[model samples]
Target: MATRFSSFVRCILYIYSFSTFLCLHAHEARETTESYHLHHTHTVQVSSLIPSSTCTASTKGPKREASLTVIHKYGPCFQSNKDQLLVLNHTELLLQDQSRVNSIHSMFSNNSDGNKLRESQATTISAKSGLPIGDGNYVVTVSLGTPKTNQTLAFDTGSDLTWAQCKPCAGQCYKQVDPIFDPSKSTSYTNISCPTPLCTQLTSTTGSPRQCSNSKCVYRVDYGDGSFTTGYFSKERLTIISDAVDNFIFGCGQDNEGLFNGIAGLLGLGRGQVSLVKQTAQKYSQFFSYCLPSTTSSTGYLTLGKDSEISSSLKFTPMLTLSQRQSFYGLNLTGISVGGQRLSIPTSVFSTAGTIIDSGTVITRLPPTAYNALRTTFRQMMRNYPMISSSDPLFDTCYDLSKSQSVSIPNISFFFGGGVSLDLNKVGILYVLGQTEACLAFAGNTDPRNITIFGNEQQKGLEVVYDVVGERIGFRPGGCS
Candidate 1:
């Protein structure tokens, strides 16, 4: 009787243990399945031209995968000339991929967790277009000489400085844009004196600064867009709104017609002695803003001052300084997410600390894998919208003009230094449109030139503040408009 009782008790204990083991296994399986579903939803299949390494999890700059061949067919100043000449020369440059520049993973994992705002009397400005012209930030009209010369010309930030195609040019010169800077004749034009602060930092991708023994101030600048501007950095009257500030100038290259206009020069923005922002910030508090209008609008505003309209929700983030040779702000990335789903991209994408917060571009470009992952989620969210197609070269995706669907996409956010987060509407984060059926255009194609790019379209309705003195920036969703 005793043996039978002991055996019965053992059997009961064994059954209880088995039941608990099964429950534990079932719970683990459910957790894993949920995780897999979340990851797969955000993965996109991108063109294989871009490398997989570009999407790694480091804060390094992006790598250029291929060369871009841009043949300028028409520009506003020279479109009527009908010249097929390659005015803007395209070169292969190493650019920082935007994806790798900001990592979402690190943003959440790091210490201090980016929650504090630096105590400073912060100023704000609207972002502007750095191309075509100043976008109204610093409108500098150039001529052969001082006010007496009156050879009025336009100023462009896309170009490095203000310069005309010079006479007896030493390099390639296209015939369509004809007005050239005459170094020999402009009486007011004198060589930027050597040993001056500007001369030490003068440089470009071409070679060392030409000895300024003559009257022409000379320097060189390589652009993020693969265009190189060679010119002199000199003192000129720069009109920033109402103030006539003496600023360093860029006398651009004759070959620049490949990418530049017949305009007298470029407006420097690099950290060198001749940069427009560098020179002007000395007196104006180093605060500026550009209000880029919607793609449908024809005009915008570029204001310089402490703009107080920046969202109170904004947190100032740290800025990473790149090599002196390069321009544009750089930042470290942690990772990115859609809805709440995290992506499983490689860590190489954000390894280099070389991403730019540029206002000139129209869309955000990323590594093949990273771009695919985000794009996949974006397409899914936008799938319900009606499709429309147009011949407009500017349109990237097709959408139905009449189909009005309430936007239901989630807000996309970016995590950067100082615990700052930048959020945007779901549709605003993508470069897709549903204008028509069967006609799909990828407006912002990921090029080999830049691994990642954050363009103007993503900046719509956002207030971007540049506090140069503070070495920090604050971005607010929606515009100062």
Candidate 2:
């Protein structure tokens, strides 16, 4: 009887153990399925992907001291004669963008030898401008010279020297919508003399040693596409809207040629001492914010000073200072998430090459490791949609959603340092080629070590704030209405 009781107890214990094991396994399976669903699934309607035909005005934040309207060069909002518009196709625009990127990479490569020049300390001032020019760039208009000749100039954060084509055209000048700025006519125009501290500063700013032209400091800037601008380094009165700064250093190009799209010249917003950001650091406190419109047809604004109201909404990440490339803004990108699921990309993949945020680059370039994981996951999530072939090598994942009124897409978000996650707007996700065709806006770099670029396309509808004094970059969504 005791043996029978012992056998029965043993059987009962065995049954309970087996039952518990099955339960635990079932719970784990359920948890695994839930985790997969959470990460791999995001469904956005197709109609939300299309951009509006009319211009969407950007919403104003707190009252900024100085603000300028930002316009797309090819958009209808930019008022210029037909001759002034140098419209480029998508392919041409991408090519120009690649050229800009190549120039940046080359600059870094050339300067990596640790023999980089140091920027000189000099008294600086502030200025502003307006207007839109170029195929993929945004432009602003600013008044230059004593009498306040209003000139439309393209503003570029990648470049450091504010330049405009001057009257002489000693080498040659390209056609511009505004009259060629005649420096001789302005009372405030003064050529920077060679051997001056400001002249020496040009070596660090332009990456080329300063040249003397009749005792005046001469500057030459060469773009990657063989476009060159050479002329006198001078100072003049620069007015952005109502704010005016005297003795504002700028380039008076006697010889200029490039695909400038009939704009007067460029406004340098780089971090260098000669850049507008550094020069105006006192007044603006080294603070600036800009919103790139979703479509070229839309209008956006660039504010020089901080907008106190929008401060709380912004997500900030530390701004890194690369010794080799001080002019460009650097940031650490940790990971990417698709459909709310963080990709399986290793953090080392992004850390190896480093990354920079650029205003002039049209398309964002990602490292191959990150790009492949993103593409694969994105394709799996979008398997329901029909795939289309693209002739452009830059964009491979194209989709044909012409027939579907409401297709689904995965949402993408970028994770940066400081635990900041930026969710891109619908406009930032895909490049719409036509009614039927759209392609992923991101591309993989040819070389993994090539620096990753966060281009302006992904910045659409976001208030990108650069606080140089604080050493942080901030992003606030829904900046554009």
Top lDDT prediction, candidate number: 2
Name the runs in model 2 displaced over 4 angstroms: 1-56, 59-63, 81-84, 110-136, 308-310
State the weakest 10-residue window (summed lDDT) of model 1. Answer: 62-71
Q: Model 2 clash pairs?
A: 129-141, 129-142, 130-140, 130-141, 130-142, 131-139, 131-140, 131-141, 132-139
- Candidate 1 lDDT tens digits, 6-29: 999999999999999999899999
Each prediction's total of clashing residue pairs, residues at least 3 apart in sequence or on different chains, is: 89, 9
In the range 1-481, model 2's lDDT, one tens digit per residue, is 9999999999999999999999999999999977776554444566666655445555564345488888777666566634445653678777888887777666565545432222211222121121111333788888998888988887787777788999888888887778889888999999989877768766445655566878999887777777777898888999888888888888898888777757888988877777888777777888898888777778788889774554688999987755566667778899999888889899988877788888888889998999999889888888888899975677899999887886656778999889999988767778876667878899988878777889999998888998777778899888874
Best candidate, TM-score: 2
